[model samples]
Target: MRRRLSEYGLFFRECLRNFHATGAIVPSGRFLASALARFVGNGPAGGQQILEVGPGTGAVTRRIVAQMGPDDQLDLVEPNDRFVEQLRQQFETDPALQRVAERVRVLHCPVEQLAHGKVYDLIISGLPLNNFSVADVQGILAALTGLLKPGGTLSFFEYIAVRRARALLSGRAERARLRGIGRAIGAVLDQHEIRREWIWPNLPPAWVHHVRL
Candidate 1:
């Protein structure tokens, strides 16, 4: 209970400090986390290499860890210093996470900057795509996809109708930005989406987009 509250407090502060990067005001709910973890380890292949991007306070990562196999390894890429620190601390102190902590790695950097040589079989992301520019979203998606091995899966989420709702209350510029992001995401989904799940229990509802390459 204390851990969960601290996560919310830290996430809210990060959101205020940088809305563009932090994106959401709270950590992801369990339903969304479960949906996103669907492809972790890509169906018990054992030696799976998994990657997680923007795992704020590891809300979703907890589910990812649970789905991991003994031979699987996990890599986390977080851009926020505070979040990175929290992840490191969790691995070191949280009993639920300590069991697999040695197999997990935390890096303090954006997903785009991660080394491409280390391809992954499954990649899950908690990035708030609606808050980024179209070009930024495109680049991020491309980078993530490029880092996947053949038959790999990339999973990410976006709040349900968030862009549309925001557009309705924003000025012309903000609306344009939102529309562009929609198109960017649409193009990718049209090309690679193998499955999608609607997580109705999330804070504001969300859609988990799963792409297979």
Candidate 2:
């Protein structure tokens, strides 16, 4: 348990650093894990082919496996080498995860590079949109939408309050611009045929937007 806590601590610290560096905030593993569980349980049809982007430390990956049936497949897209290595090492020995392990395809690449023709049943993301430029966010959403099968769902969570608070505290023009960019991205997502839902149980709370295409 101590080791597990230490790993999570490291993950959280890395998440903070990434947030500062790229404006990409990662949800807490516990929160993401629980959300994935809930998503699977409430899925219209049981989760079969799932794809995850920015699975920083496999927090949601583990939960996805637990919630999915043995026949399900999970594809993880991660760009960080260290996190990818950690993912491989962490689940290398679990029996229940063995099938998911075999089925798991960890693409050591960015989401933008994922091939366009493939579609998934569900796509979950932990990328922070508050840090991206308008074009960047649009490109990402387009790429994600392209990867989803028609009628498939794409779910993502973000801590809008924290980002807005940070912007207010900074009191800078750049921060304000970023806030606008964030809103624009949200608007674009809303304009798409996606449904948005906010969940408060997450640390710092979050809004989970589900887009069914």
Candidate 3:
């Protein structure tokens, strides 16, 4: 009973911390983390270099590291300073992570500015696409594609909402408009022969876009 209470307190504190940092609420459940772990575990072994975008609170990172082999590398691209600090502290004393720390690189910038020059074997994105503009999404997609190696995969999970109804119910666009954005992104990837998969297990569910280049 005491352990459970301690865990709940930690969760609450983390949620409040995330809220203050991103202006968005922390995830209410662990479904998305589980989904991402399952996806990584089922992916091809050749995808040794993994790139994660927006690893809030290191939930997915912990899972990714667990699934990764010794030779595998994981790169984290996060824009939130507070979350980044949290990630650094979380993994700092971890031996498994330390053994491969050289292989893990954390960037304190937006996903669009990552400049490793080499393409990644797999990219897992947790960015809130529904909150971004079409152009913003396009730029991010373009950058991601540019960073993907031939036959590499890029996956993303996001809320299904079309607009910021909870925050600004008045500025919300039509649901069709939101779907249009998703379709547009799909079309761009199809042009490059990238396949996509959508999953509905997350809170509000999510669309997981997978592309092979």
Candidate 4:
């Protein structure tokens, strides 16, 4: 209980310090995590490789660990030092994560910087695409698609109505940036989006997009 509280505190602090990068004020809720990890347990039991980007404090990471197969491998990419350390400790000490500790690697870098040699069957992302510039979002999406296997699935979520709401209150520059993000996402969705699930239980209800490449 105490550990979870401390993790939330740290996450909140990071949000204040780096709103664009940290994204959320708190870690993902259980329903959101489950939706993001929907593909984790569906593959062939033995040789699946999964990658999780921006796993802040391991909220979704716990759900992924719960669903992971004995021989499955997981790679976590997080640029925040505090989050990276917290995730490493969670895998070392948390019961759910410890069960699959040997198969987990917490990389201290952005997902775009992840090596190219290894591709994954499932990629779950907690990145805040709406907070990034158009080019950055495009690069991130390209990197994610590149890391996925031919038939691999990528699951990610964005707060519902965020762009519309932001546009209502933001200045012209912010509105234009949001439109660019929409264009980038639309381009990807036009090509590969397979399903979109809505989770109304989240703080700011979100939509989970599942894309297959």
Q: lDDT per residue, candidate 2, 1-213, as tens digits?
A: 764675566576776666542233343557656664455534444447788898877667777877877566788898877777777776686565675687788888889899946788888887777667667777888898889887777887777476667776775776866777677666757666355556666666777677677
Q: Candidates' TM-scores?
A: 0.96, 0.82, 0.74, 0.97
Sort by lDDT, best first.
Answer: 4, 1, 2, 3
Model 3, position 4: C-alpha lDDT score:
32
Poorest stretch of ten by lDDT in candidate 1? 39-48
The ten-residue window of minimal lDDT in model 2 covers: 20-29
Lowest-sum lDDT 10-residue window in model 4: 39-48
Roughly what TM-score does model 4 have, to 2 decimal places?
A: 0.97
Over 4 Å off, model 4? none
Q: How many steric overlaps does candidate 3 have?
A: 2
The sequence of per-residue lDDT tens digits that candidate 3 reaches over residues 28-123 is 245666556554645555547789988866667777887777567788998877667766765676675676677788889998988869777888
- Candidate whose TM-score is highest: 4
**How does model 1 score by TM-score?**
0.96
Give the Å shift of residue 185 in candidate 3: 2.2
